[model samples]
Target: MLETDRLILRRFHKDDWQDLYEYLSDEAVVRYEPYGAFTEEECKQAAISRANQEFFWAICLKERGGEVDPIAQAAGKLIGNIYFQQQNPPDFMCWSLGYVLNPRYQGQGYATESCQAIMEHGFTKMHVRRIAAMCNPENTPSWRLLERLGLRREGHFIKHKFFKRDAKGNPLWTDTYLYAMLAEEWPVK
Candidate 1:
């Protein structure tokens, strides 16, 4: 588990399925995501699948009062998630980052905090040499967050992503921007 001042990044649990569904089921939240919105069953499966992964983390809000307690940890509300998947051969030491957050929790800087923690972990503990992330070009907030995290915008793929179907059942193709950072470029704080 990883802790920030106001958040805890821990592995997903079966009990987190409902909380994940709350956002995963929202079309607005998942519109830019490749998988789009998910059904309750899919959310449950996702929770279970992610729980088995080493790099996925459920972003939870730390309990108040600045005191560590088991009950508080158990009761901590899940607000988002962050993950990094190895993207290349073991010798390459590369990873891809992804994240999602509850819409109600937007504009709160939680995404940035959670991403920073995960990126640091990936670079230092996981021995990752490079990390990359991508988002729809129109997802201003998302790309902006990537920029704020010091990831350099490397490429913009035009009409390369077939995200989902529109109301007319036509494939929805969107442009994507890729951001990346090298371990050597990341400041060690």
Candidate 2:
């Protein structure tokens, strides 16, 4: 488990399926993300698949804490979710970070909190030398978030293919960006 001052970043679980579905099905949340809204079954399958992954986290506020702990914990409300997609070759010490927060919870700083926790986990615990995220240029929020995380803009590619609007629809091309941070380039703690 990964802990931050106000949150705990841990693996996704079966219990998270319902909440995951709620958030994952939101168009705003998945707008910049590769996948669009998910169906209920899709959410369940994803939760099951994620439960077995080593680097994914179900972001939440500390269930137990000092007086500062919020009266409620951070599960069902799902301000957002974050995952680290491993590089194709397991030998490579790198990952791609991805996240989506509920639109209601946007601008509350939850995204940054979860990301900082994950970054610490990736570099210090997961031994990742390079951590990266891809953003859609049109998605200003994600674009700016990557910069806030100290990840440098590696490149901006035009006409990148993302998921289709629906299962049987033709794919659409959008401008995408790749941002990355290296162990040596991390900001001083």
Candidate 3:
């Protein structure tokens, strides 16, 4: 598990299914995600896939600080998730950073804290040079979060991308705003 001042990051597990579905299936929690809500089967696959992977850790809270305490929360249960999809020779010249916090946990500055930790991890541990986040224009919260994390708005692709939809189904194309921060531009403590 990855620990922050008030949070922890770890992978998903079978026990997380009920809470996972509780938040993830809630449109408010995943409204901006690329895909619609997941089925039980999808959630199962997700847990298994994430558990088997080296990356993919759920964000939990230390709350009171203890060893072996699943003290962190998931998708805003306590904190939220911060993840990276790395590239050997990054095609886009960056790793994609994604996070989702339950609406009940919004505006608490958890995303900012979690993101800051992961950003440092990506640059220092992963030796990444650039990291970026993509969000729909309508997702003001996410956009604001990226900005709060110090990523500059780099691109605004209009209707070039789609989400929660398929191209074959009239493709409700959506505008995607790309925000990025380079290792050199990262703030120094």
- Worst-scoring 10-residue span by lDDT in model 1: 64-73
Q: Per-residue lDDT for 114 in model 2?
A: 86
| Local accuracy of candidate 1 as per-residue lDDT tens digits, 59-142 | 998863446546866468888888789985879999999899999888989999989998888888989999999999898998
Model 1 lDDT on a 0 to 1 scale: 0.87
Question: Best lDDT goes to which candidate?
Answer: 1
TM-score order, best first, reads 1, 2, 3
lDDT of 3 by residue, 1-189 (tens): 556776777777765665556567777677778777877777777767767776565766565333445432443343455667875576545788999875656687878888888888888787788998899989898899999899999999998776655556766788999998999987743
Q: Best by TM-score, which number?
A: 1
Query: Candidate 2, after superposition: displacement of residue 82 in Å?
Result: 0.9
Clashing pairs in 3: 8-60, 10-57, 10-58, 11-57, 11-58, 34-164, 60-72, 60-73, 61-72, 61-73
Candidate 1 local Cα displacement, residue 97, angstroms: 0.7
TM-scores, all models, native as reference? 0.91, 0.84, 0.83
Candidate 3: global Cα-lDDT?
Answer: 0.73
Clashing pairs for model 1 are none
What stretches of model 1 exceed 4 Å from their correct place? Answer: 64-70, 167-169
List, residue by residue over 27-98, the lDDT tens digit for candidate 2.
877776666789999999998998898767787656433344455444434445787878978788889998
Of models 1 and 3, which has the larger TM-score?
1
List residue ranges in candidate 3 displaced over 4 A: 64-79, 91-93, 165-168
Q: Which rank order by lDDT, best down to worst? A: 1, 2, 3
